[model samples]
Structures are given as structure tokens and as C-alpha cells.
Target: MTRDISGQIAVVTGGAQGIGLAVLRKLVAAGARVASWDANAALNETVMAGEDALALPCDVSDFASVQAALDATVDRLGPPAILVNSAGIAGPNMPVADYPPEYWARIVAVNLTGTFHVNRAVVPGMHEAGYGRILNIASIAGKEGNPNACAYSASKAGVIGFTKSLGKELADMDIAVNCVTPAAARTPIFDQMSKAHIEYMLSKIPRQRFLEVEEAAEMILWTVSPANSFTTGAVFDLSGGRATY
Candidate 1:
């Protein structure tokens, strides 16, 4: 339970709700000065209003928005020593042939390109500080390739690959860059998925249940903690026996 991230500055993207919010709350409880960045301005303000945390409006898909949020975070809480890149979207599920091109592009923009933008913006500060931890949230679909959710699966796959490449690039530093491939959690993201698609995902999980955000957060907290110093460019599996490799 000792996260060893006390007094650190941490940023959790998509922190207004779901897994991001879960991780943000955990970081604060572990004594980190936390910033919650999300595109939902009103929801973010409302959710973070009661907590001792900074809530910033950020559209991760846009580099300018990501940059502004980073600047505000640094100005207010100092450079982030920990980053949880949880901002993502689950585009509507459909067969690859029926999926709209626009939807595919948008999903990639947020889930893949957005990961790159946030990581790219934060790394320089971490490099200068000579210490940092980063955890990018990916999905089991990225590894196994889920049916009817081609965009989400593909975008998450990109996250896995990006995490590996960036983690290796910064391996010489004290920074640890890693990713988690989680089984589907019953979050608001499920709202974008069809009932059949959701059922399909659950059936694939040998645990026979959806993942809990808190369960995911617990693993994420440690993965981004100072204790995780030796591991980088690795993928942590949170798939509840669903991941074979």
C-alpha cells in the first residue's frame, strides 16, 4: 500500500470519470499532488471540485490542447513525475466492413495519436528532472483482436507498440514507460459498445466478469510508482486470465 509517490506531481488524463478518475483518486490518496485532465469540462469540474485536485480541460487528440494542459499543470503543480495516459474513446462497434471511415479516423486520433502527443509533451520535463513513470492504458483487444470493434482494437494495438518504442528510448533514464492491456471494464465506454459486443468481450474473459476500475487502478498505481524502477518497455496484463501471452 506504500506507493512511494508521495509529494510527487501526477497527471491522469481522462480523469473525470471511469478508470482515469479511479487512478486519480488513488494517486491523491497515496499523497501525490494530482491533476485530472479530461475533455468533459463540466463533468471534470464537478467530479474534481470536491477533491483536492486540479481539473483541467484537455482534448488529448489535439496537441495544442495537450500542451496547454501540460503548461498549466507545470505552472500549478510543477512538472509531473508520474503520468497515466488514460484518455481514450471506444468508437461504436461494428464489423470492419460496416465501420465508418470517419469513426475509424477519430478513434485512432484519440486513442493512438493522443497517446503519442501526451507522452511527447511530458517526456522532456521528465528527462530534465531525470526521473518519471508513465503508464499508458491499452486493452486486451489490442492483443487478441476483438471482433466488431476493429477501430478500438487497432488503436489500442498502436498504444502497445508506442509504449514499447518510447520505453526503450528512455530506458537509460530513471523513467519507466510501460502499458497495461486490460480486459473490458464496465465503464462509460461501454455506452459506445453494442450489447452483443460487450457480451462477446466478457465471454472471452475466463474470469467470467468485467474488470473493476479499482482493480485496474491498483496495478496501475504500482506500475507508475517509484518501486517500478527496473521495468520499462513492458506490457502488464490485467486481463483476468484472458491474455495467453
Candidate 2:
């Protein structure tokens, strides 16, 4: 049965812009009450004006922040049945030998640990409701390690592992935990990368073009929909024909 997510509450981290905002828009159009959880208050408010999306200030890297955000979201929008972990950072491009310790820590904090924090906060609600959908935004760099991106690759790899384990643990339940690995999209995230790095990513894509945020968001919506029943502990590929597997 196709799940019409009408009236279901959804929380999208990093919903201020990029793929997160795109997903937020789609979910709202699908009849879901959506919350835009992001650290960027100004941008979030700006984007959510007429969209009617609740804007919540959340720093996913911090467990306290995540818990508070989830609490606030539930109080305002009702318990979220859909959770999308799209908040992440692409550390500066550099060889592993020259990678900054601080960058490595921040990358892992926001990308890997952040995923853990949000899931921890929301899963209990889903468990109670006996239905839930989670989608983590991973990266193609994790599958085929990028040359100058060790922190990003490692952190994303951890996200993949975490999703797999969480999905398996929840397979017996109605909650579905899965992640998607997408090739580079022309989001503000690209501002963190170097020209060389961007060109390298483009050269690798058989499609020879960057991904669109709308394209990525559509698959994510479907992944979290009721139609996706029985597909858990899996990785969905959106790598522009780059992933060999």
C-alpha cells in the first residue's frame, strides 16, 4: 500500500537550505507538518515563511541540542514519524597527512555523531507509535574514498555503518532505518570544496553533471514512505552512475 504521509510530522535537520530544504518543501507538499531543524536561524526563518514549516534551532552535533529539538518538535508539531538527517559538513580538502585535527573532530561530530544523536532522540517516539521512517544523507566519498578527503570519507563511512546496524536492530519493528549516498550536488556545501576537488568529482560521474537537490529529495521522500516497507539496513545509491556496486 502506498503510504500517503498526510498529517504525519517530519523533522529535517539542516533544513535551512540545500538538500534539506528541498526535502522540507517536498514533505510539506505531501501533507506532512514539517519542522526545519537547523543551526542557522536566520536562513531557516527566511526559507520557511510562507511554507508554514516550523523552524527549530538545532545543532545536531550536540546530544543536548538534538534532544531539546526533538522535544520542542513533538510539543509543537506532534511526534515526528519521519526524520531526515541531512545535516553535515565537508571539511576542507587536503591530504590525510595534512588534515587538521580540529576539522576531523568537527566533521565526525556533525556528520557521524550527529546522526546518532537525532536517531536516539526520535526512535523512542517511533517505537511507541509502531511506525517510523529515517533517512540519513551519506556521501559517495564514503564508498569510493575521495583523494583529498579523509575526514569526510571516514565520517560518512561511519554513518553508513551506523545506518546498517540501526536498520537491522529495527527490522523486527515498523521503523525503517536507511541511508543514501549521493554524488556532489551544487549546494552551498560545495563552497567548502576546492575547484580541483569539484572538478575531480565531476570527471568521475558518467552522467557528467552534478546532482540536483530536488532529484535527491524525491528519492528520499519515497524511501521514507510507506511504500518502502521491507527495505531496511540498506544503502540507496544516488551517485550519478558512479557507484560500482
TM-score of every model?
Answer: 0.97, 0.98
Task: Encode model 2's per-residue lDDT on 133-202: one tens digit a residue.
Answer: 9999999998889999999999999999999999998999989999999999999999999999999999
Give lDDT: candidate 2, residue 82.
95
TM-score of decoy 2: 0.98
Go through the candidates in order and give each one's C-alpha lDDT: 0.93, 0.92
**How many clashing pairs in candidate 2?**
0
Task: Quote model 1's TM-score.
Answer: 0.97
Report backbone clashes per prediction.
Answer: 0, 0
Question: In candidate 1, which residue pairs get closer than 3 Å at backbone N, Cα or C atoms, i.e. clash?
Answer: none
What does candidate 1's lDDT look like per residue over 144-229, in tens digits?
89988899999999999999999999999999999999999999999988999999999989999999999999999999998897
